[model samples]
Target: MRATFSRKAALLCSAALISATSVMAQDADIDSTNEDFALDEIVLKKSKREIQTETATSVTVVEQDEINDRQASTIAELVDSVPGVTIVNGASPQGSGINIRGFGANGTYGSDQKVLIQVDGASVGSEELYRISTQLFTDPALYKQVSVLRGLGGSFEYGSGAIGGVVLLETKDASDFTGGEVGFRFRQTLQGSTNGNGFASSSILAWQPTENFEVLGNFTYNKQSEQKDGDGNVIGNSAFELPSWAIKARGYFGQDREHSITLSHTDSQVQDRDVPYDSFGTTSDNFGNVDRDIDNSATVLTYNYDSLSSDLINLDVQYSYADQQIDQTYVPGSSPLEGGPSWPFLEPLVNSNHRYETSKFLVKNQMNFLTGGVSHDMRVGVEVSRRERLDASAAPGGTDDRLAVFVVDDIDFGNGLTITPGVRFEDQNIKGNGTYAGDYDNSAWMGGLSARYAFGSGFAVFGSAGYTESMPIIDDLGTPLFMTQSEKARNYELGFSFSNANVFSDADTLQLKATAYKTDIWDITSYSNADTVETKGLELEARYVHSTGFYTDMNANISRGEEFNAGVATDWRNSPADSLRLTLGKRFGETLDMSWEIVANAKMDRSTTPTPSFNAHNLRATYIPQEGAFKDTEFRFGIENLFDQTFTPHLSTRPAPGRTFKVSVAKTF
Candidate 1:
């Protein structure tokens, strides 16, 4: 069955790509050089071409400079700076997880990992939530920018699993084709209470050919070793504390290379202590360790046609592949009560592997009735994706095959108001092998509508509503111990934004944006659990950029969520009642900058479940030296958990890292 599905998927993808290529070739009058031909202007909402300010959905774009200035090293760190996102760092780099708008369903506090991750334009995650590591994209030096879409309005463009939100990592590309940049960064960290020390260094180089065709690539490697201290010490008293390491590489090609291709790969390994069966009055004398690793690679190809002069068309094709592997072990110590009388405490060593491949074909057309004042922007596309899973145990291997086709239309009703409506149809088949046995066929249809009105200048109000669906991860469907059903969601949102120049003066300007959203989800797939949930929230962000050297900005978000069993209400598991974040920063002269950021998170105490605790406070400063080879060099230092507050972020199992100070230095050339 799997073989048959693979052949059919391949044929379908080839046909779509061939058809799109033919359309581009036949449109001889189209101008391939038109900037819009590159799809760079794609507003990213529903994969339609619309002005960013005119879209009803709330989207935030974070540039490379912002990431560098803020010293964000991981997606989790970066999302925390955004108004409505939260991250629970894993026991190590390999176990990290993200929670958006309280959608994580894992039963343990800070244990949920529902948030989905994507690179370029493809999804990357284990069927289970936090099971997938994101260390591959952790390097700040390789990316050009990141975009966060706050609701379901954009889920159509990327598919389901984005019920909470979507994080898109847009990598850097060489512009001139012949130029390249080289840079290096080094950082050191100290844990106040644990007396643990860590140091890391990274370097990156990118190059583009002077010709129209070009290739850009970057590589980063990081390693950190520390002693088991503080909360980590209490959990597992192993002599060799957990060690973290990661390596990443990416490449892009495009015409002098016009076609674009990308490859990204990452490897991560960590040792984590595990304690199972706490109620058995059995505390083991020996510690168990978990070893985890992941590797990912993706490639995308696009063709541009400038020779065609027809307004009837634009075309693009993309293909991507990802492979992930994980290995876990539980080593039993020599304890009479812990490993059983005959050292029977050892858990089975397990290894799992997953592979994913996707191919997409898309065509866009915009026509203006020059004489009729009627214009239409339309897009039609098709995609095929195949996934396979392998496990060391006798448990069944899993395979999923999906085929999807969609179309969207945007009509300008004049008066700065435009209405967009679209629909997508999908068919998926899931099959399990080995001890796990199950076969299911599913179909889904998604539709949405969005409208925008601009009030002259830089101000607009927009709203959108859509139905979205997400499939349960392979583990959730095929695992022996924790199998569950699939999941789907519906999202509604409305938002407004105002941006102006010369507001307080030509030297100062302010931009304000706010949004309110509600999400209803069913069969929500938790990492190793399942439940239904309803999430509602509001988000507000204000930015003030000054022509002068000083600027300040602030943003905040609050959300409410609840869990239900079958159809009845249950405790809100792993959900927070309220969360707020604020940032104030200023630039002093040309060489100095400082910022103070605060995060306050609160969860209503749930005696039924150990609710995550609340915490706040952080301060940072940056200095750039002037003159010489270090002219653009920058140094940053910051302290987190300023008060040394000790609290458990993932229920009572894992405690948040206590007070720590970090310093980093970087130079660009």
Candidate 2:
């Protein structure tokens, strides 16, 4: 049994952590660089890993510093290292999307809307279109933080049907550059990559003319050509021209800044020429390749009022409208569709388009109080949203109106035990127009329980049990194979964590977290007759940071899935191959830092066709010369896929990228 899992342990022993934030943040103002932290207290700072150790669920945070270090061409590549998370459809930005815990789609096929993606308190990615991905399609430079909360244990507040998890992206604020000072500042970054012959430019203008008002404007221009796999083969439909921009403003009023309002807008466009109909898969001879014009944009407004005299009266109100549109134009004389049972009714798809516009409003409040000798942290909220699909291709076109109310309470017993229970009630009306003009009403209650106990010895145990019902959208209701009923899922998890300070020195720390979970979903619906699916997985993360600026981090994920139908069991698409990712790095007194990474994926044992495994290596380094004339400049360099091993990732139709060199430089004034 140990031999079967020796690689998991071996991978852990060969891992490294990214721990340069502390060393970089510790410098005083006099010795600071362009990206310096103008703070008084530095020693009490905490790294990303340390903050993650305090969470019970499977959560990961990718901050701006790490984002700058990666210099990835796509968002898929930006968050590749997170455990139990897969960003599929890397071949094209328009087809890119996220799959967490086997809940999302690949290429363009999953109708299950289990994963929730939010940017600046606005939900953006959600759809079911033919040969089109409903996943995220945005540049990585727009956001300052990317947070993932995996599993149903922590997804109730976000929305219903988040059986996989939730991803939250917060964009950069004006304060990031102006530091809340009454002045103007500008920053620029330029990056280039060898694999795709790509270049990216980012410019930010921040102005804070008054303490009560601040605004930020950002513009990004990115272009990348087709890339080659390790075998030096060009991956077709991989090229894109993208230009994105964002404008954000925040206004503070009232005494002590008790009230604030924010308005932000962003737009991104990706245009690809003669790409495969299935951007993530092989080109269909019948349809061949086509030109794709994809646009994703969002506008969000937020208001907050936190009482100065009372900690019990805190409130937040937010409203957002986001749109995603994809337009495909077919080339002349590309190939004609062969005669089939549905040929007579099918018209030549000279042009096809799908657009989704969502408007959402939410109000939430939090209070901290004591009741019956138990300290209670309570949160209650309401969310109302309307999503409309316009002129969809072969899919339903209509609007879905939904209202959700939720409450979550975190109770601390003061005896080293904490229990959190949350619940949500959602009511939605799906209305279809045109051919499938019908309205359906659905409502359900869902929730979960999580508890953790700390032993005061740097060790803790936690567990969660959750159940949720998934409501079918208009696409599912109007498809040929219709589904009127909601799917039900029951999930359970058990985990433990250990965190120690001053492990070898007062400045060193070590942390480990492990989790085992199982999910049984009844009434599962798919294209075929498959139903009643069950899955289980194991996840582990370990990290160690030394006072000497050396650190190591590793994570492992293994999942197995099966579906039963007519007394026969078969492999489920939700089952993903096991993977292990490790990193090792050190900080040379904040002036220079380097890290090496390894990502190993196991074969798909249940795959009908043989799926091989592969390992990819990456090295990255950054330098910032302190106390020099060029102190306002920073440089970064990286080498991806160092060995150039040709292999395809499991569940992917295309081969991964080859060895690529990347470099970037940034300056602030």
Candidate 3:
């Protein structure tokens, strides 16, 4: 199954690229920029600066326009379209995991993403609660750009969990001025061979009253009905059926709005279920319904000041809070055992709730210096943050807190070379009043260096090395039954990029980039069997762009990783050895655009592992009529899992949705 998916992905990628080239050839004045086209103009979220091609670190900027063109509904879907990133779906889009550079978050509790998520420089998770959800920022229409910073540069500025990288999300700022845009979309999906259906809808609105003062607001509501098998039987032997819903909102404000402030909230609930597998086959039973709820909110304020003619400084202050609750009830037949009790028969219930809050402040400064007839652009910053959390259950409650300070500096050499070095220090404390209780304090330091040297106008070589560490999660510090030792990691990488102004023709330009990277993780965090272990691997990504309207991007990564325990057994849900993504986009005339994307991953062959390799292709076409109320209107249609492949990407989890099709329309005033 794995090999077949790989081959199909390769073929579809090739066909899409060929189609893009043909479309580009038909365009006139390929240099046109007023149409808001140009890959180099891509915005980044890491540095809070708009850097053109050839300067920033290893970064992948996925623009909202591109996201809209692909008709993506979730962050996982969009990130999977990019090269070198893997997204594992647990049961539904709401319960998904993302991995980069061979490092991913744990899936058991839906916690453990190695990449940290940030919105406009403010951390998006609760400091006291470690398993916070990313669904708070689900409205993609509220974002201006999504930046994926890979390697050391990412770890240096973002801190430890960023060992794999950092995903910085910048939402629309109010200061952008007095105007508003509103949009709505709906979608339907089919779960491959299952007799189930899913549907979703979203709406968003953003506005600015005057320069420096603006407000943006967004809300999304979604619900999926229970799903059953074609034979009227429950699939996966899941204890509960597939029914869930979510809601989210955010607001932003600033003076003239130079100094900015923002607030956000999110909530979600799901039914309970169980999985059963044997030599015969795999299935799920709908035992009963489980109720899960998550609520999160944050406030951030930032001030930018011009200290001197040649210097700039900025200060930021933020506060955030989150709460999570889970309630589960067991149904009798929900258990796979023979003659198991029927639904709602054996009523067993468990409830857990967690609360988290954090306060942080940081200062940044930039200056220009000249020496030895060479000019240098330099930047420095300092940060401090405090976080606290409380977990409550029927037994008792647990609490943990931490404080940290960090600094960073970046220097640019006039000759197309720039280097950055940074470090952070953290102080942690823990206390418990339940079955497991203790108090401990520890300090950790992390740092890295990155440099880029351009050889000519169209080529550059870059390399970096960094060390990062993550303290144990709050729950991991309880008692022997709950506590786990801390884990740390170090990563090193090197790569190069090539660009040509007119590689194809005088009116055309082509850009190609690739990178090779390796990461070593020690005392890696693992659950179930082993408490700690080690893992390592390499990743590569390449992209080609033609100014004549053709663009192709491809990424591939494979790694060999293992848990060291002579007696303990572990499997694939912990990690995957291989993953790949390919995407192609083209503009056909002034009113039409088309794109295709392919995603595939290798199966976990280890005895303890249970996931199988699978591949899926998506085709999208957009039409903009040249007349009537449809001038700025667009019609989008696409089919996912073109071959109707039925497989699971996670161990014994929900199977991938089978062959799904969707169509939607968007109009911009």
Clash totals for all candidate models = 29, 7, 33
Q: Rate the local accuracy (lDDT) of all candidates.
A: 0.53, 0.77, 0.51
> What are the C-alpha RMSDs, in order, of all predicted structures?
11.6, 7.6, 9.7
Q: Candidate 2: give the clashing pairs.
A: 16-552, 16-553, 16-583, 16-584, 17-551, 17-552, 17-553
Q: Let me know the TM-score candidate 2 reaches against the reference structure.
A: 0.91
Residue 495 shift from truth in candidate 1, angstroms: 2.6
Give per-residue CA lDDT, model 3, range 296-342, as digits (tens): 44445555554333344444444444343333333334344334454
For model 2, how does the per-residue alpha-carbon lDDT over 1-669 read when each residue is reduced to its tens digit?
113213234333323211433343541111111111222111222332433555567788888888888887667676667777876656457566677777776644633687788889888875766556746578888888888888887788898877778888898999998888899999999999898899999999999999989999999998988889998998766678889899999999998999999999988997777766665664454555677788899999999998988878789999999998888887655546635554344333436777889999999998988988888889999999999987455666888899999999988876667889999999988888887788788899999999988764567788999999888777765563343577888889999887665656656667788988898887665435777888889988888776677878798899888888887988876677899988898877768888998989988777664478888999999998887888958899999899998987776666778898999999878
User: Which ten contiguous residues of candidate 2 have the minimum total lDDT?
Assistant: 27-36
Question: Which sequence of candidate numbers ranks them by TM-score, best first?
Answer: 2, 1, 3
In order of appearance, the predictions have TM-scores of 0.76, 0.91, 0.75
Residue-level error in angstroms, candidate 2, position 393: 4.3
- lDDT score, residue 39, model 3? 34
- Stretches of model 2 off by over 4 angstroms after superposition: 1-51, 108-111, 336-350, 479-483
